[model samples]
Each structure stands twice: as C-alpha cells, then as structure tokens.
Target: MPLRLPPLPALRFFEAAGRHQSFKLAAAELNVTPSAISHGIVGLEEALGVELFVREPRGISLTATGADYLSYVSEAFSLIAIGTQRLPNHRADRPIALSCAPTFASRWLLPRLAGFRARWPTVNVSVDTSHRQVGFPVDGFDFAIRMSRAPVAGTAWTRLFGERFVPVCSPAYLATLRDERGALSLQRATLIHVNAASEDWQAWLDATGADAIETSGGLRVDTIQLAFEAASMGLGVALGRKPLVDSDLASGALVEACAQTVAAGTAYWLVSAEQADSAIRRPELADFKRWLVDEAARFDADVAVADAVADTVPDGHVETNR
Candidate 1:
C-alpha cells in the first residue's frame, strides 16, 4: 500500500495561493509567475478531483473545502518546518544575532553576557545596538530586547522587568546639595538629562510632588551612559534607571541624590519574530532565551527582597552612639 497525495509542488502552490487569496501575490512570494501558480492550482484540483479555489475576473478565493484544506496544509508545513529545524547540523555554526538599544546593551546586557558565554561557549553571539525598530528575518536578528509600554505587534515577547527612575549623583556632588539639617536641596543643583529620556525629570518631579523644582534647565546629553558618566564625575545629578545603575550604586560610584523612585510605566521585553519556527527550534537560541529569562527573574527576586526590607524600616530612623 502507498500513500495517495497530490504533487508536492502543486500543494505548495495551493497553500500559498489560499493564504494570499491571489495568484499574483502567491506567485510573487514563491518567486514565480502568476500563470505558473494558476496552472499549479488547476493541476492540484484536477488531481484531487476537487476545486480548491473560486476563480473570479478580479481575483480568487478559497472555497469552503479549500478553506478547511488550507488549515491542514498550513499545519503540515509548520510541522515540517519544525522537524527540519530539529535535524542535527541544522545551522549549528551560525551565530545568534541580537538587536537592542545601545544604552541597554552597555549598561545591562554586556555586564551579564559573560555569564552566558561561560555557560554556552560553543554558541557565538553577535549583538547590534540600534534604537531603530527592526523587521523580523529581514533584519537577521534571532532575538531583541525592547523597552516599551505595550507589546510589539506580530511578535512573541516575555516581560523582562519594569523600570523605575531615580536621581543619582556622585557622593561628592550629593554632599554639596545637602543642607545643615541633612535635607537635600535641589534649588541650586544642576540637573543632568538624557535626550532619549527627555521627560524623565518631569515624570520624576510629578511622581514625587516636587512642584517647586523646574525641569527647564539641565546638562542635556544624547545618551544615558554619557549622562551617568557626567554625574559620576560630579558634574550633576542624573536620572538613573534601575539595573542599569545597580552596578554603579553597589560600587559607591553613584548614590541616590534623593529617596524617591518612580515607576517608568514601561518594561523591558525579550522579543522574537512571530514566525519563529526555525529560530526557536535551535538549541543555542533556546539555551540563550532560557538563560536570559532566568537572569531577569533572579534580578526581580533580589529587588523584591530589598524593597521588602526597606519597607520594614521606619522613616527617618537614624543610628547614633548610645
């Protein structure tokens, strides 16, 4: 006994035609002529003894049977794609390309990427730091980290972490801003601003209810990294983003100028192309995704514990000699 089926090429043409609802479009996608698509679908109908398309003067559409059959065909192709990707030696040497914002790449990812390399030394990774939105597969990126308030359309994404902004400055710079009673005064302080996050100061002010402070003036820089450097050099106070500034804060290179942290209303997300059958199937991509997500989870857990401890401490409580 043998399996009965239409020609594979005919089925391929039929699936593409059914999906696009136009022979011209399907032909373009398959890099063939419209006549080839029409003939192929006709041959497929003749072989199956059933019409799969309703041809009209303007265009073509899937028949009821065609619509149902398309579902099966699409699923079959998807399974084939998944299976093909699982094959050994399937692009194992290809490096995993990633795209993300420059600030995030420098401040957050680069610091932690060594851990990933240590874990999966065989998988090479190339990172592109660009703020421009990229088209999947076309841009040649297997993964991306994006900061956004809403999900990007036509992609699968996982929330990395929400952002919180706080004022930070070098210890020496902060010392100049404190008054006799040890209260911070911002009236005479120079505000450092990042052009990419122009509204950060205003947002922070509104969240803290500091109506007297004006945000019209500042040492504006194009990048958050530069602004941080300027602040670390004791130039002024920079609005620091968590996780990015975590290392600096821990090292005592930068300290909170004030005690307020405000939600940024946006979060970091790990994104991959919506049609990611091939990329997602790769072991290297899978390992990298898992490692990145686990790292973010651990950071979140640590932040939660620190917040819990901070909440328990009474406000304005100071330690003194007994």
Candidate 2:
C-alpha cells in the first residue's frame, strides 16, 4: 500500500516551533523567517483540520489538540526507531551520544573522559557541542549536558554547577603588574573578549570597584575555549569559567589577572527524557551523571579552598596560589 503524509518540511518547522515555543527562535534554527514558520504551521493545521498551536502575545503554546497530537507524533518517532532503525552502538560496547556546550566539553568534560572510560572501559562517549536543547525523539542521543538558568522541564535533570567568570592570563602577563591593584598592568596588554562574557568584565568591575585602567580591549574570539587558548598562548587575559580553568590555574598554564570573579547567573544540568528508557539506553549515562555530580562537588571544594586562600592573603597579593 502506498502511504501519503504532509510534507516533512512542514512537520520539521512545526516540530522546531512547538519544542522551542518561539517561531522566531525556530526560524533561527531552521534558517527561515517568522512568517515562513507561521505559514508552514498554518498549512499543517489546515491539512489536519485542527490548530496545533495557540498563537499568543509573546509566544506560542500547545493547544489541547496540539499537545495531544504532539504525544502521538512523539510516540510515532519512537516507534520508527524501535520498529526498524538501528540504535547508536551500545555505550558499554560503543560510543554514547553525549551532547554538551562546546566550552564545557573542551575545558571540563574532555579532561575527565579518560576517567569515565577507565571506570567503565567498555563504555565509549561521543560528544556534541551546541548551546541548544536537543530532545530524544528526533535523535537517538542517550544524554545531554545542557546549560540552563532553570531546570529542563519534562526531563530528568540534575544540577551540575553554577559558573563564575574570572579574568585569566599567562603568569608572564601578571609579572608586569608591579602595582598592588595590578594598575598600569593590563592597560598595556590587549583584552580578549568572548560573547559568553558580555557581562563578565562588567561584573568584575563591580567586584573590584576600580577605575584605574580599562580592561576591555583585546583579541575578540567567538568561542570560550578559543579565548582560553589565546590567553594561555600569551595573547591577552581571558574571562574564564571556574570549572574550565581550575586545572589550568592549578597547573600554572594560566594565572588570574584580577583576584575577584563574579557569577554568570546561569547553571548547567545533565538531562534525560522519558524516551531515555529505550533499548539503546546505556547504563553509562547514569554512571557518568553520578561521576559528574561528584566532580562538581570537588569543584565546590575548590571554590571554598580558593576563597580561603584569597582571604588569608590580601586582595592585591598577586602571588596566584591555588
């Protein structure tokens, strides 16, 4: 029997918009426009003879019909996988499809991956680096590490760690800081900035409350890992995350330019949805999450150690001890 369905283009648009709740954002993801998504949804609803979304002032929401239809679509995709598709090779036997933020993956998870492998030698982990929420039905991803200000609703979520941004550079950069406030210090050096740190320098200014020199000029990088790399290579001071550079600072690859660091007003979480129960489900995800929480606990300990170390020494001590 020949089967017929609405065009996948329309379904894809609706799926993205429904999941994100903003056609504008969905458009960004789809590389389309708000009007295009609205048109596509209109076409889809007309084809089905029912509206899939309730248009709202600020954004769209699932209507009762929309929500019910979504559940069916979600299950249909799952059935497709279970009924015919091959699962991602078993994590215990192959790579677990792990998703994470690029910076977090590079600076944090990669450093600890070997340990995850050592603990479960049979388990292999593959990482995806995008700063967006990926759900299970579309892709067979086993788990995702998401940076969210709030817990990811409708998923199993665990608090990973909150972030704090601090200015970091090579020890050689700070050697020139002959003054207590590091005054006349960074002005001579370029200040590399990253998009994630839009508020970082501003917050540091608040923390230090100084106007001695402008610390806002240097090589601009699009990615945090690149910024850290530049900072390590003597390019300029980079604002870095606590977990990302804790190892670097301890190893002296990078040194703090300013003693004060401020919170980034966001956090990260490890999430798995209900579809996580598929046969492709790997025990290693649970294991990895437990390991991550413990790792975060150690970072918390490091923060405490850093604070105590900072208190014992004065603000402009500049010795840069762990």
Candidate 2 RMSD to the correct structure: 6.2
Q: Per-residue error at 107 for model 1, in Å?
A: 2.8
lDDT to native, each model: 0.82, 0.74
Per the 3 Å backbone cut-off, how many clashing residue pairs does candidate 1 have?
0
> How would you encode candidate 1's per-residue C-alpha lDDT over 1-322 as one tens digit per residue?
8999779998888877887788987787678999999999899999888989998898888999999999888767766655555677676578888999887898888889999989888889999885455545544578899988889776889998887888899999988886677766776578999887798898988887776776888799998889889999999989999878888899999998875778798899999867666644567888898999999999888887877786686644211111
Taking the tens digit of each residue's C-alpha lDDT, what string does model 2 give over 1-322?
Answer: 8888876788878777777878887888778999999999999999989989998887789898988877777666666755443445532355678888887887788887887788888877789875555757465677788777888556787887788778898888767654655453555556788875566665665665545546555688787788888999988888878878887898999988876677777788877765445533546667777887898788777877777786687675433221
By summed lDDT, which 10 consecutive residues of candidate 2 come out lowest? Answer: 83-92
Candidate 1 wrongly placed segments (more than 4 Å): 1-92, 314-322
After TM-score superposition, the amount by which residue 302's alpha carbon in candidate 2 deviates from its true location, in angstroms, is: 3.8
Query: Against the true structure, what is each candidate's TM-score?
Result: 0.68, 0.69
